[model samples]
Target: MLSEKSEQFLMSLRLELLKRGKKEDEIEEVVDELRDHLHEAEQRGENVDDVTGGSVNHYIKTISKEMAFDKRIIKMVIGALFAIVAFFLIPRMVSGQLDLSMYRIIFYGLLTFVLLPLELWVLIEMLKKYGNSKKGYIAPILVALGGFLIILAGEFLLREYDGESVIVMEASTIFWLGVILSVVFILVCLYFYQWFYIGVLVYLVLPDLFANTMTDAAPGSKEYINVSTAITLILTVLALVGALAFYARYKKNS
Candidate 1:
């Protein structure tokens, strides 16, 4: 067995390679080779630092440069776009509203194609630079908070825009579209074994649906909206907690 530090180094290298879009098979092969090498080195009374020439980050970069980018990144991007569309549209479809505006399209496009990827890249760079230090997390946390605030502001602006709707579907059409999207989303998630994302969708959409049925208040009234929002928030928190617990258990078992 390798020392904890060596294991952590290998894990970090693996993550960095993943962020760099290296092939999953190649990453595992590299990791396995490194694991064996590290094990042998540990047996000889050497440490991870000695193996990496005292700079693990440099070693990781060197390895990353030698690996080719995976072509599956294109499929991953398409999947992400589909997921984002489903995430936003499913809730609106539940409310029987399918209003599409140019402004909304542009804003969501920038958010999905630019901001989210930029944030992920920034986070990956931070991870590569700072490793597992607490201080390293502070910058990424701040960036995420800023992004959240920007999203909230954008949403507020969107609601107040008074723009002409580009497309407005009838209730029946919206319902069918929602059903199709939901089926596709569920099937894709199941195929990929992405149970956490399915949980997120359930927590986000079901609360609103249930609140609408349970609350006596008018659908668009402040009271009804508040009840729905509260329920959604509660379920979202529970989903997050459940996901974290599951991840911890998975890691422990692995």
Candidate 2:
């Protein structure tokens, strides 16, 4: 049991680190170390201030400065690719039809390139905030929200220019080809230990599987789409659970 003063100091440190943009992993490590030090100090009946040199905020800043940034190139690359796919291929799959234009493609391509990195950073931070303690709800919601936003962006882009949104009777074979490629991409990410990419791909692939099958976007077709959407959500939840379990097992063996 930590003393009240020591717990307060630790919480302050956590908040300071967050404000400094320190990664969650780094903050947790720092807190763990401080906790051990505080435990020893408490056992000795020493003041917590003495352990922190009587300056908690200053120590927090110092630790923040010392922590290295986690700038993984692979993560950035995967995020960028996802942005392109989400904003481009995914909307087509969801609608099962589109009369796309070059200008729309270029516009969304630029938007995705600009925004995806920042979004991925937030996603990673969220994952760190919510550790993998077998909870699947949050992960699916986050993944689905990101994909849904991108799909909406694509729809808006298509809608802006008239005569560019067409209805088709079937999903093109090209779209299925893209699905196969996505599965390959997911496998590759998994091989390289990019678990976040897997989650994103799961959202992309599973929802798409259901959406691709529903070709009727006419009146009274909402029921089919609604059913597909529900199935997609359930699949997303299952994927998260399986992912967490796989991750735990892999870590144990590793």
Candidate 3:
């Protein structure tokens, strides 16, 4: 039961507040205050609704269009999707094909079950706290971890499903996963990186898993595995460091 004149005044004030960059909650508080004022006046038996000005609803509509860019729902949507994806990926790691390179399976499985779930939970938490952007760190770290885990899981599941365990199998999986992990870690470092740093760490740490596979890559001998491991480790670490720095800065800025 707001008076027409008071309602119009409130509407104009709301528009002015919007232009001044007042937050949604602030504007809403003003609306409640104006409503209460009108209520008090009406309680006195005065027709404040007929006091003067026109309808306020149309003005409210005009102001709505300007505040459209302050949306936060998209981040929450992304968080939910990340959680669902992590959940689905976890069960797939334990499929019958996980034992090929038991180490690979172990690595990916641990990351998927452990790190991915952590990322998912944190993401959900962040979504719930949409007003805060400090949680953006969760994205990059999970992404880095995902890079290594995904490739390791794939190699292990695929090779184990096919029932292979030769040096060749280990070597192939290591080299490939190393490359994949390194790239993923770099990306994780650069953007939503809280989890992606794991991928970079995996690249640094996973080379020892394939002792016999490297000599074949160089045709020579002694330095083959050592050189390969070093290259992979260096590249992955650099990527992780750079991307992680960027992500950290972004979070701070947000």
- Alpha-carbon local distance difference test for all models: 0.78, 0.65, 0.51
- Candidate 2, residue 100: Cα displacement in angstroms equals 6.7
Instruction: Tell me each candidate's TM-score.
Output: 0.76, 0.51, 0.26
Return the number of clashes found in candidate 1. Answer: 0
C-alpha lDDT of residue 135 in model 2: 34
Ranking of all candidate structures by their TM-score, best first: 1, 2, 3
Question: How high is the lDDT of residue 160 in model 3?
Answer: 56
**Rank order by lDDT, top first?**
1, 2, 3
TM-score of 1: 0.76
List, residue by residue over 66-139, the lDDT tens digit for candidate 3: 44433444554455445434333322221111133545545546555676556655554443333124444465
Over 1-254, each residue of candidate 1 has an lDDT whose tens digit, in order, gives 77768876876788778886889999998889888888889999988887776565688776877788999888888887778777877877765566778898888888888888888888777766666678566868877997898889999999999478887778657756766677778888999987767876776677556655676665577877887888888887886898899899999999
Query: Candidate 1, after superposition: displacement of residue 100 in Å?
Result: 2.5
Most lDDT-accurate candidate: 1
- Give the Å shift of residue 182 in candidate 3: 13
- Pairwise TM-score winner, candidates 1 and 2: 1
Model 2 lDDT-worst window of ten: 128-137
Of 1 and 3, the candidate ranking higher by lDDT: 1
Q: Candidate 2, residues 181-214: lDDT per residue as tens digits?
A: 6677777677877777666656655655565565
